[model samples]
Target: MSEPQTEQGKSAMSEIQIPEMTGKVLACVDDSVYAEAVCDYAAWTAGRMNTQLSLLHVLDKNEGTTAQNLSGSLGLGAQENLMQELAELDQQRSKLEMEKGKLMLQAAMLRVEEKGIVNAESRQRHGELVDTLIELEPETRILVVGKRGADTESAHGHIGSHLESIIRALHKPILIAQQSFAPPKQIMIAYDGSATMRKGIHIAAASPFGRGIPHHVVMVGADTDVARAQLQEATDVMTKAGFEVTGAIIPGDADIALAEYQERENIDLMVMGAYGHSRIRQLILGSTTTAMIKRTKISLLVLR
Candidate 1:
C-alpha cells in the first residue's frame, strides 16, 4: 500500500493539481517603474492574441538576508537569543514582502483591466524569479517583463540581473518592456543571415504580435551584394507572411545602426534573436545583443 500523505505532501499535490492555464500572456510585476509598462504591453499582447493576462510577482529568496547576517556575528547565549529574534524578524519581513507583492499584483491587474483585459489573474510566488518563471512556463504563451526591476531601477543602462537568466531559462518568447508603453505602429527586425535570426524571422512572421504592423528588416554591415541578398531574403519571408515589409542595409555596428534606424523610422517594437554568439565570443568582444537591449528606447520582442 502507498504511504499515508503528510500535510506537506497533500499541499504539494494540490498545487500540482491546479489546472495549467495555457495561452496566457504572463507578465512579471514588481515594485518597479517598469511594472506599469509591463502590464500595458502585456495587456496589448493579450488583447491582440485574444488570450488571458496573468501577472506574477516573485519574492526572491536572496532578499531579506540582512537579519540572518547580523545574527551570525553574535556570540554565545546572546547569539542564541539574537538568532531567535532574527528568525522572527526575517519571518515578519518575508510576510510584509509577500503582502507588498500582493498589492503590486492587484495594481497590475487593475492596470491591465483598464487596458481591456477583463479576466486577468495574479499570482505571488516565493523563490528566485527565474525558477518561478520556469515552473510557470508550460502555462505561458508569451512572457512579458520589464527591462529593470525595483532593485536595479536607478542603475541606468543595465538590465535587471535576472533578465538574462530568465531569457536563457525559458523557451517561450519574451517581450522586454521599455520604461513606458506605446502601441506598436511599426516594428524593426535586426536581421542577420544566421540560423537563429532566421528562426526569429519565422516566429515574427507567424506571431499575431506584429501582424498588420509594417516591418523593417534592417541589416547592419557593409552594403555588399551578400548583405543585400540576405536583407531581401528576410523581407521576402516577412512579406510572404503578409507583413508590409521594407528591407534596408545600413553600414555601422548592429546596436548603433539598429537604434538609429528605429529612431529614424519611428519604430515602436524590435524583434531579434536573443543571443546569437557563443558566450566566449560575447565575453571577449562584448555582445551586440546586450548592447541593443540596453540602448533601445522601444520595447523588444526577443526570440530564442
Candidate 2:
C-alpha cells in the first residue's frame, strides 16, 4: 500500500524525543568493515532518539598479536631476571592493547560526528566483550553491532560468534548493522501477529525511534481475510501513533517474500520479533533471520 519514504518523513522525525524507558544508543566498534556502518547507523539512531551515543571497544584476553619466549640457555639467576622482564613485558603489552582500543574508539567517535551526533563518548574495557556488554546492558537503550567483521585487529569476527549470544542474553534491542549506512527512511516490520512481533509494533509505535518513517507490516502466506485483519489491526496501532502505516500480505515463503519486497521497495531497515515462532517456524524462521542478519542488504532492528 505505502511506498518508500518521501520528503514528508524528513519533516516529522525531527520532532522525535526519547522517552524514559530507553537510554543512550551503544555501538560496538573495532577495526572491521562493519565498524563504519555501525557508527553511522548508531549516529542516525542517536539523532532520532534524542539520546547520547556511546562507542565501546573491549580488549579481549587473547587479543594480542606478538608472542614472547624465555631464553632456555640462561643460568638460574639469569632465568629469574628474564622471568621478571617477561612479566613486565606482558604488562606493557596489556597497556599497549588498552591504548589501541582507545584509539579505535576515538576513530569511531570521529566518524559518527560526521553523521551529526554531537553527544558521543567512547569507552575501553578489558576482558571479554560479552561480559562487558552484559554489565553495560542495563544502561543501553539499543545495541548496534556489525553482522560480520574482518576485525583481524581485534577478537571479533561476527563479533567472535558472540552476536547470537548477545541477542540471547540481553533484553534490550540490537541493531545488526549491515555494510551500508543510509539513514533509514522507510521501515518494514516483518510481522506474523505474534506476541514479539506485536511487541515490536508497540515499541516502534510508542517510541520516537521510527516515527515519521513509513512502516510496511508485511506477512507471508495466502492473503486471507485473517491475514488482512491482522495486518489492519497492526496498521491501526501504528497509524494512531503518528506513523505512516501500510499493510502487505504477500504469498510465498516468509524469507523469500520479505527479501523480494525489500529489494523492490528499497527498504532501509526491517524490524521484527526476536526469538518468536513455533518449533517448525523457528526452524524455518531462524535460518531466515540468520540470513537476514548475515547476508541481507538492509539493516535489522531486532526487538526482544
Give the count of colliding residue pairs in each prediction: 0, 1
Instruction: Estimate TM-scores for all models.
Output: 0.88, 0.81
Best by TM-score: 1
Candidate 1 residue lDDT tens string, 172-212: 88999988988999999887766566666766776777899
Q: State the displacement of the C-alpha of residue 115, model 1, in Å, after optimal TM-score superposition.
A: 1.0
lDDT of 1 at 205: 76
Who wins the lDDT comparison?
1
Query: Any idea what lDDT model 2 has?
Result: 0.76
- What's the true lDDT of residue 258 in model 1? 90
Q: Which ten residues in a row have the lowest lDDT in candidate 1?
A: 12-21
lDDT of candidate 2 over 87-144, digit per residue (tens): 7887798888888778889889889888888879998888888889999988999999
Cα displacement (angstroms), candidate 1, residue 119, comes to 2.1
